[model samples]
Target: VAVFTDVDCAYCRVLASHLGGYLADGIALQFIASPLSSRGTPTYMAAENVWCAVHPHKAFIKAYSGGVPAPAPRPCAVIVAHDSQVAHAMGLPGTPGLIGPHGAVLGGYLSPRDLLARLRMDAATEPSP
Candidate 1:
């Protein structure tokens, strides 16, 4: 699944917290950075930092689990801006916008179990390989 997420969104944090649940159910998440804050803001910078981190997944987890510590404001050649543009183009309403394997969009927060159920339903309806 691909998730359009904002680092500072509370609901995004909740979804991130249950990532383990999704993983346990064999769901692999592809996180796309879509900062809610405008450019040059703290939130945007933090999102950039996460994209630039040596371990982006770990950085993202740290950011949502607690708070992202201030990192040196260095220029990042990351895809955060591109991700934001793509999310906007997709007409996503807000953070935690989930794109399922078959391109189904599930906007807003869903518990891990609900997500797994939805995915399973989708899989059941797919044409066999």
Candidate 2:
């Protein structure tokens, strides 16, 4: 379960808020943190800031939930660069995109129940090793 997300999207915030719910049920949710620079929404920059923060993942979740402004104006270009590479490799050009085990893209805002169902379906349909 790979979720590519941007910090500035309202839907992204909603999705993150449900991570715990999904995980509580034994779902392994991996993230790709895709930044949306083309939207001119400061998501990419904020992502860079979050990635550069001491607690990168936590800072991102907090900032995405509207807790505080970027930890600082400066950010690590390397971190942003790596994330960009990840986005390109994964063919993700927008925030709130998902790659389930079944090779399906789950995009847009989805409630936790919907997400759990999608993941379950994908997992059930996946070819076993």
Per-candidate TM-scores read 0.89, 0.77
Residues 1-129, model 2: lDDT tens digits: 777777776778887888788788766777665777742357666776677777777787778678764555555767666766777776765768777766677766667788788777777877788
Q: 2-119 in candidate 1: lDDT tens per residue?
A: 9999889999999999989989988898988999888899899889888888777778888998877457356673578889988899889899899998888876788889988888
Highest lDDT scorer? 1
Computed on alpha carbons, the lDDT of every model, listed in order, comes to 0.85, 0.72
The number of the candidate with the highest TM-score is 1
The regions of model 1 sitting more than 4 angstroms off are 70-74, 127-129
Model 2 root mean square deviation, Cα atoms: 2.9
TM-score of 2: 0.77
Backbone clash pairs for candidate 1 read: none
